[model samples]
Target: MERVEPMTLFGYEKLQAEVKNLKEVKRPRVVKDIEEALEHGDLKENAEYHAAKENQRIIDSRLAELATFLGCAKIVDPSELDHVKVSFGSTIIMTDVKTDEVFSYTIVGGSESNPDKGLISFGSPLAKQLLGKEEGDEVVIALPNSKKTFEIDEVKYQEIVFECD
Candidate 1:
């Protein structure tokens, strides 16, 4: 049996949109390019044809990856989560014990983690330390350079919405 992994609602929607774009738009465009390249003559020395074929291969690989993700996805709605303690889909505000700096992060599944946007994966070191911890709790996270302690100042559950492009 295949293991079903949890994916935030936003992540699921994002991947679905990507799959749609690749299949409906990119695939057709690549096919057209390949057809035009074939009209350019000799198959053995056709650079355009080779490039188009490579592009098609890349697109197919991406499509397969997205399909696999969708197959194993179990969408988790943040709105259905509780704010009592830190968990997957929880938004938390924490203060650095040493530097007194504060930061906010949303704990999400591995597939949708974007550290620059304050999204941390559940499998990450920071998220692992924060999980099941409540507000006012202090936890230590080990980094590549050093270990840092942080105090959880707030915990909340809010829906994460993604704007489709």
Candidate 2:
């Protein structure tokens, strides 16, 4: 099996908390719902019972997944972040010379990506192109549709806090 790289301590904690919620709150709630449905009679025709059982399966699966991720997690520190250029957890600002469009994105691990909120994964095309680049540098990136060019307007080291809530 491929080894899972370490996540930030905060990220690891979030996984653990989710697992705890699944086991402590969700599982019990599902069990109660199943019992109530079963009391209603005929198991084969009981839609509520079936639905509750399905939900339980999903919750249990997620709990197992989170536990596995936590077991393999390696906490990476902010102090160890690369400062000379764009890297994971670094906020980068860039401009499209062709369109005069300016945008800023923070490079993060795959699990933390939320592009709509401007938090991009390091594995993303933009992040891959931005890595090792300094301010004022121009880079051309190949996209599935076409090629685009960007100029690095600013490069700075920024701390990232992954909050669970």
Candidates' C-alpha lDDT: 0.89, 0.80
Model 2 regions more than 4 Å off: 161-165
Tell me the lDDT of candidate 1. Answer: 0.89
What local lDDT score does residue 95 receive in model 1, on the 0 to 100 scale?
A: 97
The residue-by-residue lDDT of candidate 1 on 23-103, one tens digit each, is 999999999999999999998999989999999999999999888989998988777878789988999999999999999
- Tens digits of lDDT, candidate 2, 64-119: 77777777666776458765688666788889889999988887666667798788
- For lDDT, the strongest prediction is 1
Worst 10 residues of 1 by lDDT: 156-165
